[model samples]
Every structure is written in structure tokens, then in C-alpha cells.
Target chain A: MITSLSVQWRMDEFCELAGLPAECLIEIVEQGILDPGGQAPEEWLFDAAALAIAKRAARLQRDLEIDWPGIALALSLLDELEQLRAENAMLKRRLGRFLQE
Target chain B: MLEPQGSSMDFKDYYAILGVPDSADDKAIKTAYRKLARKYHPDVSREAGAEEKFKEVAEAYEVLGNAEKRAEYDEVRRYGRAGAGFEVPPGWQRSGSFGDYAGHPGRDFSDFFEAIFGSAGRAGEAPGRGREGGRRGQDVEMELPIFLEDTLADESKKILYQVPQYDSAGRRLADIDKTLNVKIPPGVGDRERIRLKGQGAPGIGGAPNGDLYLVIRLVPHPLFDVEGHNLIITVPLAPWEAALGTKVTLPTLKGKVNLTIPANSQTGQRLRIKGRGLVSKLGTTGDLYALLKVVMPSRNDEATQQLWKQLAEQAGFDPRTEWSKRP
Candidate 1:
């Protein structure tokens, strides 16, 4: 049965979990760095995954002294590399399974 | 003979005080003295009551300084107290007894010196029995720098290092080839230490080896900087693309993705790509953010200039009207 108490989050709740101030969150939203929703800020919502990403972004800026533009480029490149690696691994696994068959 | 007022003078073993054997050569004696002198030096020491210590070291150097006095003192010590029981030696005056020797002011000797030499105020006495196997190896340290990407990728990096190795004869040799495969963990920041266990010198008598530590350093990326897992990309958009909403193809880590730019989008606008960031050990992904920059055409042809003039007259829209009203 689907329970009503299933974990869900709104944009504000996710920002709070990420330990970001409302002003910063607003700036990120206005800049389009984060999409809370397709509509206005009031209607925007985010889940736990978004909140975790936000927290990591905050730490990178605060602790690592990385600027926003640099942070974006780094994240994109690393994501690309990781995706390639994952795909390669998945293919290898599939090939091995086929061989067993 | 009239006895002196003070107590009898005690003998001192100067060779033992300098950490040298009785049969030590001149070179060994000088080396030992230099070491002790540095330890008890006044200028650099912060040890408690070190001023008194300096004076004691000075006094030890004085008697050991003169060869004639050292020889006589050594003879008196070797004879033992029983040898001096009845007859005073030739050239030695009985007029000045051991009690008279105490009348001279005591040097600022430490209790360590006093334990060996306070009773025997004279130098060159062989104090205690000899101790064996006395030498120890020196400790060493080094620093290393590593790339930030290498650390984040958890790659095994081989580092060439030179460490001091001792031969079986205990001679220190240089340029030891110690190749270390450092396993870098993801998220390792600059100046973090990766300790290589049991990689240092083999201790005496097969004791556990010392540790070699590698300090991590991240090389700065030309195009990107890592802040946790998120990546930032500054993309230049055409003026028309910014003015009117359009679907633009953007390069992401995975592949090209179609991104929508809202109408009237301003420069410095940012867009986020979800789950498109650095992969972490926790099986979680970060994000990729793109900042928009509007680039205007530097040179316009006569036809383009005429088209803009016509559009301005027809539209009658002033972009700066809001700014003028701000006062």
C-alpha cells in the first residue's frame, strides 16, 4: 500500500537540508543554476537528491575556494568521464553474461 | 698539617662525561665533545636552568683541554683511593690535601656531571663501566606533490623517490630507489598525506620499519576547478538566442543535450543539468551548471545597420526606458 508518510520534499525544505540561506537559494534559482520547478519559485519543489547536490556545491565553494564557473566545468567533465566508465563497465558485464550463456 | 675547613674533593671521569670510551682516539673525543657542547649550548637551549649547564660544559672542556693535567689526573684516578692511603706521590704536595681542593669554588656542573665527576673534581677519571652497542640511525622526512585529478580519480600513481639506506656495515647510502604506488582516494584535497606503511628503513635487529608519508597536492586545472562534485561551464550565446527563447545544443559529460533558453534571458544566466557531475564513492552524482554569456556582433554590415534602424522606428520600444525612470 502507498503510504501518505512517504518521504518527499519541497524546494524550501531541500534548501534548508542543504544548509543554504534563502537569499543564496534565490540567487541560484534566478541564475538558473537550479530548477526548483518549471513555473515560479513559489511552485518549485526539490527532492532529497537535489538537496545532497546542493550541499556538495556549497562545500566546494566554501572549503575548496572554487568559483561557480570553474565548479560547473569541473563537474561536467568529471560527470562525462564517470558516465563513460560506467557504460564501459556495464558493457563488459553484459558481454561476460552472454559468454556464460 | 693543618686541615682545610671544607669537605674532601671528589674525582671526575671526563671521558665518560663526553660519551667516549677510555681508549677513544683524538678524533672520537673531539666529535663526542662537539655533540655534548651543542646540546648544552646556552644560546639555543630552552631547557630549564640551562645557564648553569653552559658553565658546567665549559668547565669540562677546560681540564680536558690540557694534555699534561689530563695525564696526571688519569694516573691519580687509576691508583684507587687505597693507593693514596699512606704516601703522597712524587711531585704531589701533601701540603694541599683533598680538603684544600674543595676551597676552590665548585663549577656550575649539572647533577648528571656531578653524579660522575662531582666527587672526583679532577678530570680524566674512568667513571663507570662501559656500555655497548651505542649508535643509532638518523630519522628523515620528505614531501611530494600530486595532481588533483589523479587524486579524485583514485588512480594508482608511481612516485620516484630517493631515501637513505644503510648497508650491513651501518654506512648510510644515498639515492635509494623506493618506488611507491600511492592509491589516491576520491575527494583528496591539496596537501593531504598518504602514509605508506612499512616503507621506511628497516630498523635495527629486524624491528618494524618506519613509515614514508606522501603529501598530496592538486595541480590547478586550466579550464575547470573542482568544488566537491559540481562543474561549471560558461557558454557564450548569440544575442538573438538570448532575446528570443531557443533550443540550444549543449555539450555535457554524457552527451549533447538540448537546453531551452527562456525569452529575454539575460547574460550571466545559469542552467543546471541534473545528475551530471562528478561521481563519488557513495554512488552519488553531482551536477553540471552552465552560465550564459551574450556576445554581440562587433561589426555590422551596412544592410544590418539599416535593418536595425528600421526596426527601431517601427517597434518604438526603448530598452532603457525603465532605467531612465529609476531616478
Candidate 2:
């Protein structure tokens, strides 16, 4: 089946892929690092984006020695920075189209 | 960092991997590790082979990060040099022992590390070891580049990658070559990673295989720029065409379509072509934006210059009025 963005992994599989325990995933969810679809962990479904985010959170905890709260704050800031950069580039391209001599 | 010479194990240059001098203090080593880890960590960096680079850095820090381990490694490092594999002295054995595993998941230390630390606690001890109690294999990740057109429909892609194999004792073995045919569902975005279960390295003693993660990278298109599912194409227009609107044939992803440029259309004007963009996984097609760009003739003849001069004088339009105003 063509299931790229729509593919959702159950909690156990997500934990295995991310190399974290269920408690860690819960901490991440509680800290707002990821929001899997369902309300309960057993019924929760995590998409590809959540997988990437979970992995990043784990790395920050292990590599940089950052705590969960610190990682959550850093991730939100980094995401914001990426969004601003994309918007800035688009705006520059649009302005260049008109300002060209 | 280490290259095997003959029967002897190759000596690794941990200093070179972490880009630090032998005299670097603990604080300096930690700083370098943090900087490189941030740069090469696969989760954050889009650079090619960043994950491998990160592993090398991590291994270096694992040895140098601890004071006792660094002292022991330094003694052996004095007898060895990078790229020139030397046999261990007949009676020489390093004094430091491998620290108890802190349960770092999915990380495998290099063979050189095992040679130095004397493989007390190695790969096979991971949580999901083989079905017979050996650790599961390591996961592998690679980037997959796809064309914009390829994302329009479901397609099968053939990929070839190397998977690390291990002996029954969890000793590192030569990498095994593997090929797979995977179906890429439509609407994958740039940098999105898809996980394939049991597609990574084979586990020792029939343990569950590791997963293979494919990170999608969208190749830059020749004609279009992607914003979400929307496509933007810049259309060049002659001065007269911009002054007096004209219909022109434009190229779409599938075929050519006639686009009517409205009269007095200025540069930077955008015309939206509905349902001509990429199809999302939700089955919704986005709109295509045709951005207008007015261009002047490369070489203006005397006659053309005279005609332009007359029009410029007659129109009496101040193009720099906004710039001329004192804000």
C-alpha cells in the first residue's frame, strides 16, 4: 500500500524504533515533544514526523546530555527557526521577482 | 579512523576524529564532542553520511570523555599510530575495563574499541537481543533522493545498501550487501523518514532483524519550486505582453496549458492554476502558481529605442516615486 505520510506505528514499535522506553515516550508526550493520535498510549498512533521528533529527542538526551524539558524547549525553538527561514526565503524570492531591473 | 594493515588491528586516532590535540583537556574534549555531535547527528543534520560521522565522533568521546579511559588509551596510543597497524606488545595489556553499559540504544562501538577495551560488554547485550537471548542487530539509515515528478504517483523503487552482520558471539563481521524493492507512497515530503521493519542488519542467533530508515530528499526541480504541495513556476513575459495582456502556453508537470495574462499585469503577479499541483496523500491536489517576470529585449535597435523613448515620454510614469519619497 502507498502509505508514506499516513503510516502510523503503535507505541511499542515506535519505542523500539526510537530506542526509548515506554516511560520515555510518555515523558516526551507529556513534555509535548510528540502528540500521537489517540488519547491512550496503547491506542496512540505515531506518524513519520513523530518518529523523527522522538529520535531527535532521544539523541539530545544521550548526546548533548540535555534533560527532557530542555530538549522540548530546544526542539520548539529549532522548529520555529526552520519555519522562519523557509518563510524568509520564499519572501525573498517573491520580492526578487518584482525588484529585478 | 583506523585502517587494517595485516593481521594486527589498526590503531585509531581518536584525536583526529574529535578534531582535538593530544594535549586537549577534558573541557576542550567535551566542547569538541558537543559541537561535532550537533553537526553530524543524523536527526538534525541533512549532510550526507552524517550518521556515520556521528558514530565515529561518539566512539572517540567514549574513550576520551572519561579520565581513566583516556589515561589508559593514551598509554596504548603512544605505541601506535593511525594507518600503521602494529601488533600488540607480547606482554602489554591496557589496564582500564569497559564501563558497565548505560543502556544506550542502537549504538555499536567500533571493532577498534573492542580491541582496546577487551570486549567485556559488547553488541549482543542489547535489550532485544536474539530470540535465544542475544541482542538484536543494529538499525541502518540512508537518504533517498526522489524527483518531484516521482512523488505524483505510487512507485516501486529499488535500493541497494550494506547491512552489518555479526557472529554468534556478537563479534562484528563483514557487512553483507542487500537490495530491496520498496513502494513509495505518494506525497512524501523532503527530509521525511520512513521506517521499514526487519530490513536492517540480521540479528545473531536468529534475533529479530533491525529496521531500515529511508530519509526522503526532494531533488531540486529545473522548472518548479515546491512549497508544501503547491508548485511555483516563474514565467518570463515581454514588456508589451505585460502591458497588454496576452495568452501564452505554459508547461505544467503533465502537459502544456494556456495561461491568460490579465491586461496591465505587472511583474511579480501570480496566477493560480487550480488542481494542477501535486496530489497529497489525502488525495487533495494543490494549486500551481505562475509567477510573472517582465523582461526587456537583450539588444534594442535604434528604431526600437526611439519607439521606447516616445512611449516613455508619453506615459509619464515615475517608476521610482516610492523610492524617491523621504520616509
Q: Best DockQ goes to which candidate?
A: 2
lDDT tens digits, residue span B1-327, model 1 = 112223233345566667677677667766666566556554334478765655655555544554544565566557534223322234553222222233222123433233223333432211111134222222223556655446446577777776555443333345366776766666555544444545655444344444465555556443334456775555677878887878888775556777888888876677888876666657677777776778768799999999888878997888788899986
Docking class of 2: acceptable
* Per-residue accuracy of model 1 over A1-101 as CA lDDT, tens digit each: 11111134566655544556677676656655566675766787764334434554554444234566655554456557755765575455433422424
lDDT of 2 by residue, A1-101 (tens): 23344567899877876677799999999998898867788888888678778887887888877789999998998888777876787667655555756
Worst 10-residue lDDT window, candidate 2 chain B: B121-130
DockQ of each: 0.01, 0.42
Q: What is the interface RMSD of each candidate, in Å?
A: 25.6, 3.6
lDDT of 2 by residue, B1-327 (tens): 333434587678999999999999999999999999989987677789998999999889988988877887888888888988756656777663554655455567776777677655344245454345655677788899998888888778899999988677655567889988878878877777877877888877766788788988888777888888999999999999998999999898888899999889987788999988988878899889999999888899999999999999899999889897877
For every candidate in turn, the CA RMSD to the true structure comes to 25.4, 3.6
Among these predictions, the greatest TM-score belongs to 2
DockQ of 1: 0.01
Return the number of clashes found in candidate 1: 15
